[model samples]
Target chain A: MKDIILIGSGNVATHLGNSLKKRGFNIVQVWSKHINNAKILANRLDCESTSSIKQLKKADLYILAVKDDAINQIISQLKDITIVHTSGSIDIEVFNHRVSNYGVFYPLQTFNKNVDLDLSKTPICIEANNKKFENKLMNIARELSRNVIQLDSESRRALHIAAVFACNFSNHMYTISEKILSESNLDFRLLLPLINQTVTKLKDHNPSEIQTGPAKRNDKQLIDSHIIGIKDAKFKELYTLISNSIISHNE
Target chain B: MKDIILIGSGNVATHLGNSLKKRGFNIVQVWSKHINNAKILANRLDCESTSSIKQLKKADLYILAVKDDAINQIISQLKDITIVHTSGSIDIEVFNHRVSNYGVFYPLQTFNKNVDLDLSKTPICIEANNKKFENKLMNIARELSRNVIQLDSESRRALHIAAVFACNFSNHMYTISEKILSESNLDFRLLLPLINQTVTKLKDHNPSEIQTGPAKRNDKQLIDSHIIGIKDAKFKELYTLISNSIISHNE
Candidate 1:
């Protein structure tokens, strides 16, 4: 069994800790700057918790799941340990310069403490500085997930940007939709099945091939009606921008 | 059994025809401006096909799923018949002005002939000139779906605009994502679960509440990376525009 120490207590850290425990790996400890947050997860895993990185115990694997800005500071505190950061943008070399052996164990999915994450099917992107550490990282990833992808830092960053488009920007569009529906005093629930089907279509068909809209069809009457319906000035601008983009794509 | 005649052979018409046939409606005939297209669906439904609206048979319900530009001409041709067009933008009065027993029977979902449409749960937005015709349209909708919503032309137009935001614009975001992934030689399948989860979150959580990413967190560094990574000029502009919207929402 691999012994792992999680060096943060945010969503990614808690989720990875819980999933690792469920996969029968020995979690050595969980450390967070916030003692309570660290203890919450540590208590669940029956592992020790420490607010001080000085008290951090040695483990076979160390996962740094801190904020993007705090990654360097966290790695500075570690001494000659095999480390990995669950960051999409940060390079693996950030840890390489600071530690003897390092890698990236980035899970390409959004996580929340409230949401039940199934790591088994979630894609884990792994990269290591050395062959030995790479094998160890790959093994751990394989044990936890069937979809382990080895991406160079550049590719991982590219994937991360793609996720921003697919997940983050997509969620913002839903937020706009919710706002639109709410203003009309209609329950956003009315849009759920259509939303579900939109995502479902992406599973089997390319999004470009299945795209439909007044903008895509160049139906100016519907476009004009839509633009007139938006009350928020900023949202109205967004509607016009995206609608124009869709129309541009068709052209 | 309601005898229905389809007056177009587009995605919406074909999908509705197949769905109605499955639900045991006698599709008396399909009339399209294009004879071959009408024949395609008519053969599938084991019904009659005709290019000329002059040869159309009398039916309890006539569905004009034609393009918006062609809607008036089709309705003018089928005057004195109980005709309804499945249009979100056009007023039911457009039909009432031409035909005595006219209404709107708009299905508030995106349709592609290749995709399997689940009509049982798709909300059918109905509007009519009179209560008798309204009841007739409602009865037909009720037989086909459980979620029959009554909206005036104004609300249906609002709902249609919201659908553009939630479905069409959101789909373009997916297309942007697919393009980004294709640049890296990565399969679009990697992003499917993230896309699915984004939609799943909308069912139980408000879209704004479930929003994540650099924009949601105001992570300037990651957002900068994303803007730089997207090579397409238009996509980059879209990224900047959407990220600004998300950040504005948080503020």
Candidate 2:
């Protein structure tokens, strides 16, 4: 587990590679289909860079950190190395016992290469085929993050779905908010305090329990006004759908 | 103004009342339709308390921080003093020129009385009938918050609408996430890192610009898998709706 190869050079790979390298794991190789992508991350990790999959160096662990579809293609090309992926939605069965040891090392955090992240605070979900490998993977995951959990494939899938609702859908709401504010020349920054408080509240309370607004209050009049003013068909539909969902959850 | 009477005793009222009191404003009286509510806030402010509208004290500024529907009823009872309501959706025209002094002092933040808040970081949206009073309201708002703006009814309404999408709708996303995780006996806290990162990213980029998910990547197979797994009719519908919305936004 001390020697590692990070198989992607995107945001997730960039963050994880640096974090693992910081924890004194030797990032033996950085691999991407594009030489430039591999070179960029390799430069940061001070490791060997490669666009050639067949040229990959043997390491104790090879993190298959690539696109979900690309996982199969890359894994099939390698032999006899422990492999794990950093995908929330992908199944652990993707390994199909290709090697003696394989697992999933999905970090439950959104990553942007340009943005700073405290990997120690992020939750890492680990899954392996056997107890021995699971312990090894857990130790590696624990080295980078204080929060690590051993999750099975089914539970990981459920968690991934929940992550979509919490992170992706929540961000879509912000997209819609930015659109609405732009129409009236209002700065998006005006909503920062309110946005900050919304997430801050969840630290202690359930989302439905602290829910407020016309939808939660079941104020039909206010909801009606919000729906009527929306000119974008998609946004209007979203407004009505979500407001009704909130009202339903309240009931 | 220096002298103020706070009408209402909810989260907004409690926060605004305490903030104004701390700023050295003389709170002549705290009034709520319920005597207990008035007494509770008054005890905290160390001021006079009243439930009777007729017993409301005369002050340089009267902040009518009641529910939106109750504004007209409460204002019809107050006379010969400056009046302002702290509502996001309600138009300032609700004042109807009944008094020489009327305005709105809407704070653009979701407040919880039990939660500690830094009011100076919150935005105060003020609107008044006359420039003299607008300046006065602005000065008072500035005292409480560094982020204060004199917004008109139309723009204020726009900002309010945006807040609903940003705060209320985003929280609803968390509600759905909690519901999904509960079905699998998974802890909701597992999603916090992802949730925190989602909001934290907005400080540097627009939501639409930073969007990343199956839908954002236009991965139809992943989206289909998610939609198919949802058992709740409302959630299934919501998943499809929001996914399509994200896809449409990406295009």
Candidate 3:
């Protein structure tokens, strides 16, 4: 059995650990700076939990599912094992000169601890220092997901930035949409069909090719009216900036 | 059979026209400023085509699916007939005293004429000059969609603005993501899982409650690095502004 020590107990860690557990991987322990978080996730993962890095058990794999900035701190304290971090932006080279075997096993999907997501459908981007470890990581990734791809450090960095724009920033747009609707006692659920259809259309072509709306049509009169109608300065600014961006794309 | 004349041959007009045609409604004519556009849609709709308002035959309903600015021109030419404009932001009163029986039939979904969409699931927002006409519009809307909503002009306006943020602006975010991926030779399709997952999580919670990323986490380090990494001035501005907005939401 491939024994694994899943580090971190946040959304990414919790989801990845549970998904791995489902595949019959023996998770030796779950580690986090907070003992309660580790314990909570570990209990659900059917594994041991620890707050201290010193108490972490040696396993076939160490999945460093910690936050981006904290990655270096955790790396400085571990050695002599095949370790991988689940991050989109962080470089695989962060493990250089510190760990004997290090790579990246990044699943390119948004994670929420409570949300049930099929991690197998997510695109896993993998990278490693050497061919043998790369193949090993790819093997594990292939077991978990159908859409696995090899991406270098720079490409992964680009993918991460793209993800931030596509997922995080776009999600903020939905948040703004909900806020706009609330101003007039409208239900956010009313926009779900539009939202779902927006995503569904992406399967056909590039987003830029299929752009729509007043901005795409260069409806300056309607755009101006929308801006004037918006009360918040930040939203107004966002409306204008994003609208202008869309118009520029049309040109 | 109740006769209907669909005005305009654009994305909204084409999709709604075809969906109505499928429901066995008698579409009498397709109208557009350009004769070619009118002819193209009329051919697909199996109806007559006209470029001049003078050539428009009287019908039970005149569906004005034209652009916002040209609505006035189209309305001035018709009278003593039930006329409805398919716009989110436009009020039913755009026909105030200009026409006898008027209403609004707004389908709150992004439309692409070339893309296949199940219009039955789209939420059709209806408003009218009178209760009887409202019911008439409601009946037509109900026939095409399962989610027919009666929104007074004000709420519909807010919903329209929200739709822009949720659909149009969010799509622009996807466009930006694809542009960023192109910079590093990464496939845009790789980000689809992340993008789709972003929308999926919304079903379980409010978008603001579930915002994730360096911005949501307040990882100033990652945000600053991402800003530094972006070469385009506008993209950098978008990155900083949206990140600040996400951070603000977290607080």
For candidate 1, the TM-score of chain A alone relative to the native chain A? 0.97
Clashing pairs in 1: none
> lDDT for every model?
0.86, 0.90, 0.89
Best by lDDT: 2
Who is ahead in lDDT, 2 or 3?
A: 2
Give the per-residue Cα lDDT of candidate 1 at A47: 95
Q: Categorize the docking of model 3.
A: high
**Candidate 3, B1-251: lDDT as tens digits:** 27999889998899988988889898999999999999999999899999988889988998999889989877877757778899988877788677778889999998888888899989999998889999999999999999998999888888888899999999999999999989988888988878888898888799998898999999999998888888788999999999988888788
Candidate 3: regions farther than 4 A off: none
Superposed model 1: Cα runs more than 4 Å off: none
Docking class of 1: medium
Query: Model 1 over residues A1-251: C-alpha lDDT tens digits?
Result: 38899999998998888888888999999999999999998998899999999998988888899999999877777798878899989988886576778899999998877877677878899999988888888888998888998999998888889898889988888888888878778778888888888888877789998899888888887687778878898888988888888888778
Candidate maximizing TM-score = 2
lDDT of 1 by residue, B1-251 (tens): 38999999988999888888888899999998789999999999899999998999989889999888788777766658887889988877776466788889999888888888788889999988899889888988897889998899888877887888889988888888788888889888898777777777776788889888889999998888778888889889889989999998999
B88-166, model 2: which lDDT tens digit per residue?
A: 9999899888999899999999888888898999999999999999999999999999999989998888888889999
For residues A131-246, write the lDDT of model 2, one tens digit per residue. 99999999998999999999998888889889999999889999898999999988898898899998998899988888888898888888888887776989889989999999
